[model samples]
Target: MTGLAKPQGVKRMQVVIHAGAAFTDDGRLLGSLLANKAALAQSRSLPLGPRHSRQFVKVMSDSVIKDVPVDDAQEDLREIFPEDLNAERLIISSDKFFGPRRTALQHGQIYPFAAKRTAYSEKLLEGAQLELFVGLVNPGSFIPKILMSLHEDQRESILGSTDLSCLSWLNMIDDLGDLAPGVKLTLWENEDTPLIWGDIVRAMAGLADDVALKDEYALLLSLLTGTGKTQLLELIQQGTAKDRQSLRDSLAGIFEDHAQPEQIEEELDLPGWNSDIVSAFSELYEQDLAKIHTMPNVRVLHP
Candidate 1:
């Protein structure tokens, strides 16, 4: 791997870290940001691909966990981000940044170490401005999926004595606020991603409102039928959806009629779970979102 050089006498480094709540995104967010690399570069923003992200995680682990010197850690960063790149802002993303799936429900709750992790990363970045973006999934769907990702023997151990009803994404956000209070935090619901996909990408890239992007509809397109895709392209080509809001409104209308059933539907087959439990979880998630909106220093993107 190439070494990163410490940036000097350039723009103050701004680091955007996309910490995924597991099952929310599998690099699709990063992929979307990457699709507009040329556009991002025009604004002096660099989005690190998976290789750089992994290198970053390794450096952070070595520095914080293995007691490597801060200087050494900064040197390792030089490999991931060359000094000559001179980018003003850097974007790094990984779902595992929040911790592996097995560790997600630690301490009888979700991501209890999240705040400390964020703080450690900030410190290791040599005081770069920190921004965190995360997408939250309703536990009704999130829990079962995460549980399924784990080994059978490991599942019960991680979830010991925790009440499913008590799991709250807001609690995790609150911890971030209290511990890494200086970090800018951005959040959105996974379900709302398709609708707010453009906004999410623009926010992460710090792109101007008037700036345009390619593949903005990639995620939304993946979930649509051929007919839906054709209709959407026509809508855009004809300039029917003049603004962001109007485009989103048009997509909503199209999705209602043409979204693929299997792609949009989340299957739940966990033991002792039913429609009622899922509905209750969805209700709690909505309530948590309301409280999240009121949080200071946090930006919640909506459709």
Candidate 2:
């Protein structure tokens, strides 16, 4: 794999493809071929005959917006626009779409077509250099569902961060991979982890007609991660045969109500104790249980 010399200011563009249709099997195959061809063509195309610098045009996807500036107009168009209009320029065409919805584009300058028209009502045509062309394409059945799962607020936050432009182009792709896996693990481990420890405490207290479950819930809160909860539960189980059985039964009942048996098994099979889960426990401890004893109808059975 030959490394393409990093283009000047290439680090500024960190575009991610959130639209699911962009990752189809055919799309992947085509994109791979295009990337390779572009890379190879770029190397040979350099070192112009009479003019040492050659004018080259490259078509990039919306993912490129992550690294490139989208907010500041000057910075966003620096590479594509002429430094000196007289100088022989390299025209790079970025096929990025800016819309009101969540996109990989990080720069603030490029507004969604609708936003551009609204914000700069009169200057829309004069200020906007790029034209948006929409085509009817089948984006797959699950595309809408995937977009919906990525909440609008969270998506907007990620897309709107100015610091996001500093992120490496490669890292943006890696982040998408990490996000899917992280969410999947979170779902799988929901049973073992104390994600809903408060609800469990309330339910148990109501059912048992005793507030002792609140203390147990507080203890369980300290074990927020799957590994921590699993290990802590094991330690508690070792106290006595009766204690072990009782604790196991309580946990099993809670798990059954919240998650499927397969999910519990999957959580158990996951490797290692991630520190992020520990941090989650710390956050919950600070935010939710700062004054656990002061709460009404709550009893402290175990610290």
Candidate 3:
């Protein structure tokens, strides 16, 4: 694709779409990034582009806020992005792209998300420079969350029929390809939030490799209380990289020691799911994560 046209002689704009694999981000990525844009730019945490917040908002809104008529999208883009603004990239972050997160029945069937099969069919960023970034969670946790969102009516028809054992998050992600053909897709497991949080921010910004970043630890600060990250940092600081098992062990210990007791606990009020079922589901979740790590063209961001 030639990319979204800019002014007569301006540079092409890079667009990043953070299509949510729900129950993942919880708004921290966009919230913290936008809040610190000014300071971040000063420190060169992200690639510098349109420096003004107003200009930045325009770029994001036009791409994600509402429908930009298929016929006039190019014209609309030119208006939203003035060449003089020198916008380096546009980012549209949304969980709504695929529709509400829900499943009427269990047994591994995810509902309505199929509509997302064509969600990007409009080619919202058709001619523009575009990149798609998605976060995924194992069906173990994801399936339950979708059930929680169900209304009274939906609960019976949908939640009543779910069998958590048969869920597959990989299938959902793989489906995106057929819907939005030929798009460059990047996949990262949300379960690794703490370790790869910085990478996520950097990747989204389309920043350079050498740009020294400040506040890299800011994302974890909230989740990891005092002394919570010490051991993990020490392990990472060691000359040799640790194995997956060791890393997981260190992180689990640190988080257990530092995480707020209440925060770590979950209350899944769904029927047919007691602590045992949940634990089994969680075990399966870990297995799914392992499988995801091996997929081709899908980048798994780890420490």
Candidate 4:
């Protein structure tokens, strides 16, 4: 005996949350998705822009902090995403979802509150499917970037007693899986983003196999030399690299010859961080990435 009869057999919405671990996309990914917003809408997926995503984050944060019930949180979301929404999938991209970048290294851990925040995000999803997409960077570069983003006083406070070697993306992933169960987690290396950007966009936008978006190679092209860019574009135009793997394979060869090393290489200069430490962090990162490749409840997208 309800006030209004429920609609029969309507599909549930699927929510894709891009929870940044920071300095990964730097808003570029969202920018790329926004570029294809028209196409995305045609495919029944709405990529929430920065304003909408901020509103969503604020609503979820208030609910989590104020102990607001799930129903109330959902009602708040309805204001942002109307009940008559025409999309089957909603995409929200925000690095802040992992917490502020300044607190990234707190308690000797990377994104210590990621799992908890993710759980809160899930609570507001109502009946929709939730997918968490996280982009991870090597702590060698990741730590330096984080420090550079913080003020002098804030850096030391966040790095309190933290052993840099102890930071592991694998651990963060495990925590996300254990603490935020029932949500699919998709991961890719920031280093490999140039190669796999197409797949990432498709997954985030919930695009069908035949639905193609423009500028999938924008990142890859930026790092390419003049000739490299020409050949890569020609390869795509001529159907040489017809699929994701084939394109990746072709791009790898081109990168060897035409990638601008200066653009591809990240210059690292920070207090107490040297070549040796960076190398060690990189080695550990590779090892962790290998282990993550085999983990359950996770999908690791590779170049």
On TM-score, the leading prediction is 4
Give candidate 2 misplaced runs (Cα > 4 Å).
Answer: 1-72, 84-96, 100-131, 139-145, 148-303
Residue clash pairs of candidate 3: 4-128, 104-158, 106-161, 106-162, 107-163
Which order, best to worst by TM-score? 4, 1, 3, 2
- How high a TM-score does candidate 3 get? 0.71
Deviation from native of the Cα of residue 102 in model 3, angstroms:
4.4
Error of 2 at 147 (Å): 2.3
lDDT comparing candidate 2 with the true structure = 0.29
TM-score pick, better of 1 and 3 = 1
Local distance difference test scores for all models? 0.82, 0.29, 0.58, 0.82
Q: Write the per-residue lDDT of candidate 3 for residues 1-303, one digit (tens) a residue.
A: 133555556654566666677767776677656755764454333332333323333443454436655555445455444555434666656654454554323436553453343344335455456566778765556666777777767766664466557776666656655665455577777766765666677777766543445565554545776576665566556824356556555665676578765654566777766777777877877787787778775666665
lDDT by residue (tens digit), candidate 2, 1-303: 001223455432111111212222222212322333333233221111111111111112221333333233333234433333221111111222223234433443212232222222112112222211111111121123223435777644654564321322223222322332211100011223233333332221122322222234433434245655564466445654355346556555544454434423312111232445434444543333334334342332221
Instruction: Determine the C-alpha RMSD for candidate 2 after optimal superposition of all C-alphas.
Output: 23.8
lDDT at 54 for candidate 1? 81
TM-score of each: 0.92, 0.21, 0.71, 0.92
User: Which residues of candidate 1, in runs, are more than 4 Å off?
Assistant: 1-10, 67-69
Ten-residue region with minimum lDDT total, candidate 1 = 1-10
Write out the backbone clash pairs for model 4.
none
List where candidate 3 sits over 4 angstroms from the true fold.
Answer: 1-3, 6-12, 38-69, 72-85, 102-122, 160-164, 209-214, 229-253
In model 1, residue pairs whose N, Cα or C atoms come closer than 3 Å (at least 3 residues apart or on different chains), thus clashing, are 3-78, 3-79, 4-78, 4-79, 5-78
